[model samples]
Target: MRRLLAICVGIFTATVAWAGMPNVTFPSIDGGTLDMADWSGRPVLVVNTASRCAFTDQYEALQDLYDTYRDAGLVVLAVPSNDFRQELGSAEEVREFCEMTYGIDMPMTDITAVTGAKAHPLYRHVKSETGFVPRWNFNKILFAPDGSVVDTWGSKTTPMSRPLRDAIEAALSGD
Candidate 1:
């Protein structure tokens, strides 16, 4: 009886398999959390976005990328930000614009800062570990299933670019 109880306790106490990354949660645009841990064991393409920038059109390709890879366990997360003074005035305007103009259905966060002292923990951690930060709106960060930074790119790197796609593919395949 003692051995059986110990075995059960050990099994219950075992850590999660996807324990590589720290817990990071974003305020969801849909009025809840967009927790990174929830998508553990999946690759996440996170883009710091804005509604009024020239690169705003990249939102379309982002949606397309998500549509293409979602079924394969890829998660595309849009993080709308006003750090560059280009995002819409509020989350409402941002959501309305993204849905009306781009028909985006991917997960999105409420307006959040992506750089500097007030930058979200996601950016801060990325910078500290990988020395990468959003140079401008639409910057992308690819996180592997283990929560490690797989790759990063600036505003000019479109979501559907070959290199970005390759990185996503590699991450998705656990390579």
Candidate 2:
């Protein structure tokens, strides 16, 4: 009985430590705090974005996807990052440009770190779990409804890709 109790306790502690997804806190482009914990119970697409990158046009498609599926448990977050010397502006400027040009209504977070030694906690978790970083702007990380890492897509993968759609469907259906 003593051995069984100890084993159960160990399992419980490990589970608690590893349960759900890793937590992250970033700032909104407007200087407000953005907490990943608030996204609990929702599947999210975390994308590293830049204003001047070649793939910056993906923002339109991403916004389209978000508009299409957001009512169905999809939450797309655009995180502007200058990690690659791409976005060379302040958060407010990036937010204004994206909103004015693309009409992006999804969550627009501050310029979070996405690579090298200063990667944000979310990006660190993504790179460690998925074995890849945002090689360039517009890399996407899809979180499962249960907050686990579901898939990571490179810049080449369009927001409308079938695999992304299918993965999101699977995550939603599982909920």
Candidate 3:
């Protein structure tokens, strides 16, 4: 009985540890898959974006953040979401708008649902792990190198905001 109990506990712990970002992936907007495994040793900033939202301009800040920290092993993943009904109609439209309007070049996922039962698996995992659902477009979730939630920010928290930048710096430094 003791041995069986120990095995069960070990399995439970492993499951819990693997339940976060590392276990999820999404369809990359460019092509193929965007596996979390590809970003295994880096901190990732996962942002839910909307091309037509008031906060859409945040894309430029996000790009700046990506350009500044990507060399330090940061992955800024843009997930275009329409859960708030503020996104373009299709992934193509989103891609064009982001490129043409903001000159964004970071990795982006196809239009995805960031809330409700139809939310993508990654967002679902994020909600399960941190109880954070994107309350509005441009909400950000930062993950540590070990695939754990580091911090989350609402729409108003721009990418270069003090809190968000501090968290990214800390995560990159493995703090």
Candidate 4:
């Protein structure tokens, strides 16, 4: 009976996780908080970024994507993480670097942990629900307007990649 109960609880947890996104907030690089709930009616593309990674150049593509689809309710959220040991020394530095180097205008978070026990609540929830973790910098997680996980891409997947764009298109169109 105890074993059965455990299995049932696990099922319930997974079901709840699949139903919606975790109520998580990020430490906005601009100060204060960036609540995920605020983007409820928009598709969000979350990318874990590192300033010094080889994939860092993808920031330009990410900005272009935001510029192109933002009017259609697409939100590109840049999460600066030093989990892979490549981010700048501080949030101020990260912000300055991103704005000056990449011309980024999208939302961004401070240098937060994106792996292990110290990972942000959103990352933890995603890992627990989908077993998806950022293996390296620039890992992307696409979320539907309803807050469900749409798809994910690894470090090499550019923001303008066909597959990722298709997923975003679907999410925006409510597919």
Candidate 5:
């Protein structure tokens, strides 16, 4: 009986786990709603960023990638998560810093937890599916056009790395 119960629980857990990606609704930093569904059929590059983190310079590279790929079905969304330490200012402040410091014109979303007990819903999927996190800062998650996680890159991986750019190109091709 004990073995049977354990097997049943395992099967049930697997069923729930494989159901589908959870729908996530987050407020854009610009005070707008951004539903994950809207990004369907478009490859997405999600990054956890901070205004004061040492890796902040990646913003410029990220913006460059976005500018290059925006016409190719690539959407780079920066999510300012302060889960590590309070390294970012208000949403408005982040916007100003990104715009002035790096000239970042890509889409940016509200600051939220990317790890720990309070990790946001999208991050929960990112961490579980990709087995990675912001770790420090500037960790990236690349999702296919079908909303499936394709790959993850750490802070050490520059945004313009050949592998990343190629992945984005492949995802754009959706092939």
Candidate 6:
């Protein structure tokens, strides 16, 4: 009985330790690496983006959100992905287009897979935690300061939508 109890305790401890965000890293579009762990203490808005998708215009709103809330501890991370086959062929092209078109200066990851067997580690971790995956470009996943998923929105949800903004505000204010 004591051995069984000990085993159960160990399992509980291990599960608790793994409850939060996955420790994953991705190559930044500009340079160097992006370690999700680095943003541990700040609320992060992670969006899977595609340069050519119809919803790509949301980049403007994303930048606006970043500009509006970054001062309040919101880290907006734009992760360019080709899972939907709408992203540009190269990171440089993506950078040029985003910069010239929307003047986007937020942090972005290189072309990544947001779904399927080749999904990025961060996406996989998100799926494990929330059982949600990007159905298309512009899907948003909001993470709390502690690295847990606070909320998720589908591709049709605009970055500036009231629900998304409210959630970001709540996460920032610790509501």
The candidate scoring highest on TM-score is 1
Query: Residue 148's C-alpha lDDT in candidate 6?
Result: 82
User: What TM-score against the true fold does each predicted structure earn?
Assistant: 0.90, 0.85, 0.87, 0.88, 0.84, 0.87
Those runs of model 4 whose alpha carbons end farther than 4 Å from true positions after fitting are 1-22
- The clash count for each model shown is 0, 0, 0, 0, 0, 0
At residue 113, give the lDDT of candidate 3.
88
**Lowest-scoring 10 consecutive residues by lDDT in candidate 6?**
14-23
Candidate 4 per-residue lDDT over residues 1-175, each given as its tens digit: 9999999988755444422654468889999998887887789999999999999999999999999999999999999999999998999999999999989999999889999999988888889879999999999999987777888899989999999999999999988
Residue-level lDDT tens digits of model 6 in 6-125: 999887554433215343677999989887777766899999999999999999999999999999999899999988889999999999999999999989998888899999877888
Q: Spell out the clash pairs found in candidate 3.
A: none
lDDT string for model 1 (1-175, tens) is 9999999876644423222435588999989888787787899999999998999999999999999999999999999999999988889989999999999999999999999999988889889988998989999999998778898999999999999999999999988
* Candidates' RMSD to native: 2.9, 4.4, 4.5, 6.5, 7.3, 5.3
The TM-score of candidate 1 is 0.90
Q: Which residue segments of model 1 deviate by more than 4 Å?
A: 1-21
Error of 4 at 97 (Å): 0.5
Clash pairs, model 2 backbone:
none
Residue pairs with backbone atoms closer than 3 Å in model 1 (clashes): none
All models: lDDT? 0.90, 0.83, 0.87, 0.90, 0.82, 0.88
Error of 5 at 120 (Å): 0.8
Clash total of candidate 1? 0
Error of 3 at 62 (Å): 0.4
Pick by TM-score: 2 or 4, better one: 4
- Which prediction has more favorable lDDT, 4 or 6? 4
- Evaluation by lDDT, superior candidate among 1 and 3: 1
Query: Which parts of model 5 are misplaced by more than 4 Å?
Result: 1-19
- The window of 10 residues in a row where model 5 has the poorest summed lDDT is 14-23
The predicted structure with the larger TM-score, 2 or 5, is 2
